[model samples]
Target chain A: MNSHDPVSDCPHIAQFGEAALVLDAPGAMDLGAQQRIWALDAALKEQPGIVETGLGMANLLVSFDPDLWQAEALADWLHDAWVRLPPLAIEGRVWEFPVIYGGERGPDLPFVATHAGVTLEEAARMHAARDYIIFAPSVTPGFGYLYGVDPALVLPRKKVPVMVPEPGTVSIGGVQATIGMTPGPSGWYTLGYTTRFRHPFDPHAEPPLQVAVGDRIRFVIEKVLPC
Target chain B: MDNLALSMGNALLGNPDHAAGIEVQTFPMRLTTTQPHLVAVTGAASAFLDGTPLPPCWVMRLEPGQDLVLKRPTTGARSYITVAGGIDVPLVLGSRASDLRNGLGGHEGRDLRDGDLLPVGPAPHSTGAQDFGAQPPDETLAFTSASDFLDIRVVPGPEHGVFTAAAQAAFWQDDWLVSTMADRMGMRLSGEKLTLAQPTELRSGGILPGVVQVPPSGDPLIQLRDANSAGGYPRLGVVIQADMWRAGQARPGTRIRFHRVTTAQAIAARNEQRDLVAALRRDVARYAELPGFTR
Candidate 1:
């Protein structure tokens, strides 16, 4: 199924709070699906008095100033935006991320492969071969939820997640891939790492991050270098 | 003036954008303004100026070169102050609000401390006056202890049938107690095992905020604002937006029951609340105390 559509016939429909409406985009993780959701998300920003728009893997929660407009008006505006969201172009360029597999660097590699019924080499090859697209970094500031794990490489998350997974830790779990934003523990496979992210908050220079949702990531194995 | 404490207090007042003032949590907050300023108090707390109890959530004028002090609250968890015009902090992302969890926006992404002087911005548009409800609306319905969530409403998920009808019925009828595991990430509720009819590892799909997802444990996990963007468990339903505040105020021991609602009913309830907000009438001075206005 596409990103916005879920196999679930009755996805929960509810309000996030007093002034926000949450539409569940269950089962929507693919690039094309994310693009559709993103388009609607971007358009929702145009609604007057909207405080901010938070995009998630499966749903878009829109919150506005309750004191300003009637909730019905806001809901109507959103439902219209939903109908108008344009189809996303899937030809987005793919990025190759250099990673250092297994051993000390990737603490979860052996466990991940073992869970996936594969060897370290097979896991690495499978991980690097497929193109995983980033959905959103809202999970933990810079922590990105990259999708498209080779179906064979997927596994359930760890029973307990590490509080601090260390900065730049690359890992995969089940059908999701993650790159640590700051040092924070995780339940995913810790593969390798990179610092190609261009995040700047110099009010004068530009914005905080250069990457957007449609970008793709491809892993390239590289030897670890020291400071 | 305790510039640091004042700004930090303002940042946490109900999502940051609300026209509320800070209740100088800890004191010795001394401010000598060069010009007049406007202010107000919000949330459910009170404030004071110069060691004297100040009217909370109303506008007052600050005189030029005036030294004003904001006293701390004796009760209520958080007290807010509103300047007629909101503080002009740089808006990061799309909000002037601070996200302490991720440490983004507001001042330096940390709590405001001493000597942090603030520049005031133009006041938000005044909604003029209408009707005084005699009292502010109360969200006291928010979950406090564990037993309060007895009537939690949950609907069936697309995979609703994936669970035995009895399991689904049990999910709706049984009383679920708030588990010790609760946070901005999610709240794990303790109830009868919501066993699925069959064990299947669904592909990692999108999970929404407030959606009830059931894992192998049979207990339901209620997602929150800071929840992961996606998950792998079977979801039951989404919580109504109006009830999110209740979830936020949920401390522990909130008993919950699942109730299914039609799309029309959910939409109507949302509209009803909007009508109330629109119908609210309070002066700019009603919420913020603007200091030093001569006209």
Candidate 2:
């Protein structure tokens, strides 16, 4: 059920409430660990009494019918399943997005450049240097957090989130980078704006999102606006 | 959704409990209808049709051009209005809920504005008698609460033990005041600064509705329907699913006290609520037997 070996670390599984369970993989955020989580997510959905499963960064949230299953029993089952499950290998498509860095598009570009001891051009280059992997669905539908950001480019998310960030905005928070699927509050530092991006979500579509988890995204430097 | 109020409102009108309805918040909501309609108002708010007061949870007939006003509730914060036929908003993702966060569903994906005309679905051939009355859930499925505090039942969350003993004690015992900064997303509470026994970085995980998460500021936030899918704050407790409606009806400046309950107790409470709705559906069926009301 996985593309890699079974995860060696034991997951911390606990009852969130009467009907939900939260499972946290040990150690830091790792692709291998997250892959295992994806495997678990898919497997649990097939189980009876499981209502829904939500994906998080190296974590999984499961909602179940309390009348059908108890939390203790479910937690025990999840532990056994983790040991038997392997990392899920997703054959995902690659998407390329053109982005404009700095100026009004990216208000925090200068701050990022100054903090990283690099010029604005260098900062933009560093951000667009590598491909990013779509980890999981974020706080909202369709959108997801991207991994593989350069460690030096990482910064803690804002203590308080801004009321609104423009839709299709490209941003970085901690070691993760993401693009805004909709305009909403966010604590991430805006780095650029995706240019002429296609609609990523559609409620009418059978499969709502254009991009799937485990997909790869490349941000191409379309234009760099000066601050 | 305010499940109890919404369901009860529809039930009073001989409609299925799942029918879509208008959710009025902090109301002084007024609507003038152009077509005859059967309507019911549920929750704590009172309603008036053309200056005539209707009892709480009462259903009545509204003629064309009649004015219906939902008065601001002195206690609870929200109300529900159900028509004989559901509100005919185009369903997005199998729901009529206005997803304010994503701006994707219901009434052009935004809040209802003045001059907006809401379309109603076709009603059943027979819509039961008008001027019908039923007991409100607040009176039937009531929870014990003090005059100054709303008592909400909660189940200890996964990270409940991470908080210091004093913090845990204060969480259940103290009457936390609901802050002004509250909305569909969540209600922030101000009270004792809940601290963890040892500071630890928590990976962001899925957030459930009714989860009481503690931010760095130590204030507790009870996540609601529009909350983000995930969060990193440490969760102290979750308001039991059965009591979420009570929390939903709590207005700003209201004091809330969390009552800890076991998983079994939470399930029992949920079942009790379900039984009430089921019984109400059956009880309201009698009006359908009235001559000329047969479907």
Report the poorest 10 consecutive residues by lDDT, candidate 2 chain B.
Answer: B123-132
- Chain A superposition TM-score, candidate 2: 0.92
TM-score of each: 0.66, 0.91
Instruction: Quantify all predictions' global Cα lDDT against the true fold.
Output: 0.57, 0.84
Instruction: Give the true-structure RMSD of model 1.
Output: 7.6
Report the Cα lDDT for residue A15, model 2. 80
Stretches of candidate 1 exceeding 4 Å from the true structure: A1-87, A114-119, A135-138, A141-143, A195-207, A224-227, B1-37, B46-76, B123-134, B139-239, B246-272, B282-295
Off by over 4 Å in 2: A1-8, A102-123, A160-164, A182-185, A222-227, B125-127, B290-295
What would the DockQ be for model 1? 0.22
lDDT value, residue B190 of candidate 2: 94
Cα lDDT tens digits, model 1, A1-227, are 53244334223345443455656554545665567667767776676788766666656656677667556777666665555567555555666667777766676667767867877777787888887887765455453667889888777777777764456667877677877766665666677665454331233334555555767877776643221
Q: On residues B256-291, what C-alpha lDDT tens digit does candidate 1 reach at each position?
A: 766676545555555554443433332223432343
Best by DockQ: 2
